[model samples]
Target chain A: MSGHSYDAEKYWKANLRLIFGSLIVWALVSYGFGIVLRPMLSGIPIGGTDLGFWFAQQGSILTFIALIFHYAWRMNRLDKQFGVDEE
Target chain B: MSQFAINIMFVGGSFLIYILIAVWAKAGSTKDFYVAGGGVHPITNGMAIGADWMSAASFISMAGIIAASGYASSAYLMGWTGGYVLLAMLLAPYLRKFGKFTVPEFIGDRFYSKQARLVAVICLIVASLTYVIGQMAGAGVAFSRFLEVDSTMGLIIAAVVIFIYSVLGGMKGITYTQVAQYCVLILAYTIPAVFISLQLTGNPIPALGLFSTHLDSGMPILDKLNQVITDVGFSEYSADVDSHLNMVLFTLTLMIGTAGLPHVIIRFFTVPKVADARWSAGWALVFIALLYLTAPAVASMARLNLMTTVYPDGTAAEPIRYEDRPQWVKEWEVTGLIKYVDKNEDGRIQMYNDASDEPGTAFQAEAEARGWKGNELDVNRDIIVLANPEIANLPGWVIGLIAAGGLAAALSTAAGLLLAISSAISHDLIKGSINPGITDRGELLAARISMAVAIVVATYLGANPPGFAAQVVALAFGIAAASLFPALMMGIFSKRINNIGAIAGMLSGLVFTLSYIFVYKGWFFIPGTANLADTPANWVLGISPLSIGAIGALVNFAVAFVVANATDEPPVEIQELVESVRYPRGAGQAQDH
Candidate 1:
């Protein structure tokens, strides 16, 4: 433990913040834009339909993929910054 | 080769590949059997996870569900895929860092209570078993339709094939075999979709083609579809009839349940590092999105194509004569999935909204004027994906490929789920709790036996499926969403949640979700035993049973917090363990103890 003064608590806090942030986006794209706020988004058309339908069918899933990768990439960087990454 | 022969060749060749992989990857130890010796590359594990996660439902039935339900069915797409986001952020990496073989093992060790582990095992078994029944049923349907055998006989064949690979190689074999299955199923799914897309909109990308203009109608594909369906008295293709709350809850339940499922959870355990666990979740969705993105295109296109086949000239044109229906309809008719009643005996198929409660007076007058008695075509929704290639008149090889793909989807998922059940019984029950001193070899034998038994049970249930079994599959997600997910997430995230609180929360969630479903679905799913009809009108707070898991999960979290506050906190050492799991450091060194 002495070899690494990584501040594990601080690292954990950063990770939680990242998770919380990403999850908000995750919820917004899928449940918010896709379902509840769909009518609000009906004014913005994507192709043949409104933005909400695109979000429901296509946009949310693509966003989810991007979100996971972003989280993974950021968390890995956070691990390195805190000097807690695996050797 | 003949289409039947081609189908046999493709299916038989895929099984041969599976058995060969099984032999190549036979597990030498429990470690190998359980988690592929914990050295699987993230990308390989991602593909395996893709195959493992996309069960018979995703491959065979999802497009049909989407096609039938229109906009409302986006819940399945969003719910199923959105769960990976939760898994990646909330569960997978932490669980991988925890370094356990089974989901229940994580719960047992984390809570430091064998009783909690046992409760988790029961939850895993119920969810996995219920989920596997649907897989076996899907496998049976694929086999019977393609092989021209009775569904029971088809199920037996599927059972034997699954038992051979899963019993022999365990996770190691299933992992590689699943990678192969993923390729087959994806190719099978996408090829037809691409062809259909090109035919309809001249767009090679099915996802894009879904929104492109219908070439003949010169209107956006969806707009044309809406007009055609609406004119025939069917709900508009893009209409949102479900209450927005139920839709949100249903999607949330599915997302959480997908994140919680034991089988999907275990795929992360096979990856070596915590970071790999995170990356693998992303890759798995990338692979899954390939099919999921195409599924909507397939659904919408198939619906449009079927409509054109019936009408030919336009919606107002005369329907296809019963005697002149396409070869695909005749072929599917033999399987009893598509039936034509000809209620008016007018020699033309009358397909429209047959719901007695449809209150559109103008539509009713139009139907009466056309001499349509009621909707004549009793087409099973599950048949759409299977019938897609045939309906589109794609090459025979593509049809053969679909048969293989559907089998791959069903078999891969069934194997993954059976492995989950078998591992829980052997590792969680026998080794972790009942007989701690059980030898590694004895445990492996126990695992194999349990897997064989699972196959028989799944097969038997598929053969004579319970009436509620189909609906219960959705409830299985509800149970997982309510029970296992909250317990596991709380165990990882909340150090104050002790064994009592965890168990109490799980039991409450499980019981609450189960009883709510049983109240409407039937007590224990015994047909004719339901206290009330499973209708939205009878629902509490207008929440469909399928969507109640989200509420059940809320109940779980509340009960957990209240009980944790009222009862003892976890030991300090356990709190430290939770802290260690949250960080990504030293994950590579954490071996399965």
Candidate 2:
């Protein structure tokens, strides 16, 4: 029982860390590069518009999809590592 | 066959397919009814979620909104898709681990109070019902235009079709049909976009075509769009027309609201495992991105086509003669969505900004010199996607496919929302709170009855839709973001929030968001009943009612924290339950227990 409790705690901590990491990138691409820092990226052009327009409309969505898949893959490995994975 | 006949065949054929699928995948037990027996493959679930998430707004109006608003409307794309990231990381996996038939069930058990459960149920119903109204209205419009019926008759036919499938097979049926709907809608959406993009930019991919050089102008499509629209007194397509603060807040509100919508959240529950739930969100976005990425292309291309059609040469060239208008214009005019009053009676159609505002002012002098009267062409934004095939001169089959796609989009979402509402009533209200000992058969019967009632109510509302019915869908997102999201997130993330705190937080958020919307959008959306006009100047701290959900969420979190800290901590068992849900272990067999 004690070992199980310790594993659960460790799993929870690892999960939180992964979430924090992913969310930082999420915020950066969306609110940061997409809106706030867009002017800085205006010099770099993609397709027809500047990089910021790409991020706002197309790039952010692509990043989000990538982030979710990464999180899912990483969490599955972590679940196995912590001996908490479903059979 | 006539285009109308083709449309009927396509729409009617899709309905027939849905009915067939519903019959084959009939939900025999409550588990099957509620969460498709928790056996859905992640990719399949993803496609279903894609169909379920892209409502009438996304299908029928989103591209039009983007075409009209340009850069500012990217908020919808970003907000809608970004929320799934939050859902995957913040809510979905943990909720799946908790393993319940409904969202409110998790609230009830985790908070250790039936009152908290009931409050969550109320929030779910309010949000889902409001969201469903928009779907019903969208379906009605599609039907009225294609089937040559009145909007009311359209609503009834839509309601009856939805009633048969959703009530019969519940989640199980909705899941498979949505997969089919997703295929139809995606194909329907993309074929026209690809054709238009190729014609406009010499690029096959609409997303790339948006940025590629225009075939005719030999300049970038967006740049040319900006030049022409500005010449005609409209804002540049790539420019920021809205205040920066409003844009940021609006995007934030939509992202949070998207994460909080009950119907979308419930999709995760259908997957077999927590891992499946996480991956399914990624896959769902993959499916949705197919449309989201193309939408801008569709919008820009459609705008370019419409502009060139009306102008016939360039923005500086003389406007096209009304008598020489394309067949599509006359076709759309029958729907009353596109009107031409000919205020100048000048024989030629004059399309320009009529607003006595800053942007309109910029174009007013130019328009006046041209001897143009007030803008004669009042093209409803909703008509853009519906009329896109015709606008692009795509084949009649493509037009027929779009009608089917639009109806599929609306029906798929309406079915999803109806299932959510019915489950809340039968499983949450009747079974969970009212009759814990009710048999499975009785509960299933109750589910069908509740679904029938919900459909009737939604159809009736569709017939006499409030002026803000379209906007009410946005308000639904606000409510979901404000009330349900915080509580659900806290239940998994924090073990300390008690029943009293959760209930109080939900009530405050719901009330605050609702009143803010009512004050601006009319009291309960009653026409002429608003206390103040819904303008940026009249907003509280410049937060429009459309974007007030973010503040409501903050209030919910703050109040919940304050109240929880002031009271006794949650029980040890509830704390342990939260700890359990945080891990993905032991989630394999999450039958509704």
Candidate 3:
């Protein structure tokens, strides 16, 4: 364990943060944007209806794709930072 | 080609595709049978999970349910996709990190008790068996309706096709087969949706078509559909809910329930890395969203078509003749999912909400004028998707595609369910604890035998399904949500939970939820034992038994917490295990394939 070369603790904490952070965002958009916040968002016009309608229909879907890719990238970086990178 | 020939071509062609893919990937070892040797790529795993997730309910019943219910149906869209976020965030990565071949194995090891494993096993078996029954039945229903085969024969063919693909390749084989199934089912769902959307809204994209104004009429398509439907005495489209509390709870329950299902959870274990399991969930949601996005459109378009067929003239004019109903109606009636009874002496099919007692509503006036006694069209809501292509007068290929899509949906999940059941039987039950000295080859043989036996049981149930397809799905969901979800969520989140507490929690949830259902439904659904009649008033607080899973989950959490505090904390290593599973770094190993 010389000079923290096996920095498992630090990298592990960072991975947890990323997981929790992405998950909170994930919950906010689907349950938040699609369900609870849908009515308020619908007040702003998209094409013919309000923004909430779009969120329920299309916007939530786009956000989900982004969330997945973002989580994948962050975790991969975390893996490397901890020297657990798979070759 | 004749409609029958067209149906044959569509359904037959899809099966060929499934076989071709299964041939490409042949499972050899026990690892391949269980977790695809833990070597599937994230993207491929994502697509396979999509096929596995979207079952008969998604493919056959969803669009129809959405179409008939209007705004009240938003529950399906929100509830189904929301669970995926829970999977990606709360469950998948950690489960992969803990890294086991089966879910019961995870529970057994995590709690360090065989009792916990047995409890988890019971929950998994109950939920999965109930779920599998519907898939087999859906296959039978599709075959009976279109292929003109006997329903049992349809189920056998479906079971055989699934067995060949599933037994031949195991999880590795299933992963590839499911990707193909997703393509066929999505194409089948969207092609007719595109045509119908084009016809009604002059928009090819069904998702966009949902919100657009009707090209032939000035009002929004939804607005117009609601207008006529209300005029005919039904509730307004997008009408306010009967109980906001029930709707919210039901939706929340479904989300939690999906996250807890063992078959879906095990899909994450097959991925090669912890992070891949997390990402795989998101991709699964993306593929599911395609059909979900189209479902609202399909429902809207089908509703319009049904209305137009009902009222060729304005709503005030005479309806279509009951004797000379359309081909779609004729086909569905043979399956007994849709039936017509001319309650009024009039020959015209006077469709209305014959149940409402509201004064001055058009329904009352119409019913009085026609001397109608009650709601006469005995159509189950699930018939909407299967009947859509014929309702829209699309070519026979679309109808056949719907048949194939239904089978694909049923089989995809069935394959996943079998893997889960067999994995639990051979790996967790037989090898891990029961007989550890068995060789891998011996374990594999046991797994295959369990899977084959499960298929025969599921097929028999499907051919003579114990209940309606939707009813069976609700029972399965209730069991999964109430029993398995709380235990699993607590396992990772709460380090204080001991083996005794976890077992107690599962048992309490399972008994409470099942007993509540059995009291209302039959005793083990044995027909005469349904103590309470199925009705809103009969339910506690007008909460449907289907919605009772949320309460069961809450009971589970409370019971487990109290018991854990009263008992001792788990030993130090288990806490460290939780800490390790929390992160994605240094947590996964690549299998030697």
**Which candidate has the top score in lDDT?**
1
Candidate 1 Cα outliers beyond 4 Å, as residue runs: A1-6
**Best by DockQ, which number?**
2
Question: How many residue pairs clash (N, CA or C atoms closer than 3 angstroms) in each of the candidate models, in the order given?
Answer: 0, 0, 3
Which tens-of-lDDT digit does each residue in B1-593 have in candidate 3?
88889888888888888888778777787878888878788888888888999998889888778777775677677777777877886788888877767888878888899888887887788788888888888888789878999888998999999888787788888888898899888898888888888888889999988888888777778777877787778876655457755666677677888888888998888887777887788788888888988988888778777877777786878788887788788877877888788776678777777665643365686668767666667777776687777777888778878888888898999999988888888888888678988887888788888888889888887777665344654677777888788887788877899887887787888788778778788778777888899787788887777777878888888888888889998988887776666655554553321
Say which prediction, candidate 2 or candidate 3, comes out ahead on lDDT. 2
**Candidate 3 residue-wise lDDT, A35-80, digit = tens:** 6666666567654455655665566666767776777777777777
Q: Model 1, range B116-224, lDDT digits (tens) per residue? A: 8988888888888888888898898889889788888999999998888888999999999999999999999998888899999999999999989989889999998
Per-candidate chain B TM? 0.97, 0.98, 0.94
- What level of docking quality does candidate 1 show? medium
DockQ of 1: 0.67
Stretches > 4 Å off in candidate 2: A1-4, B360-362, B466-468
| Candidate 2 vs. true structure, TM-score | 0.97
Ten contiguous residues with the weakest lDDT in model 2 chain B: B240-249
C-alpha lDDT (0 to 100) for residue B402 of candidate 1? 91
Error of 1 at B373 (Å): 1.9
Q: After superposition, how far is residue B229 of candidate 3 from its true place, in Å?
A: 0.4
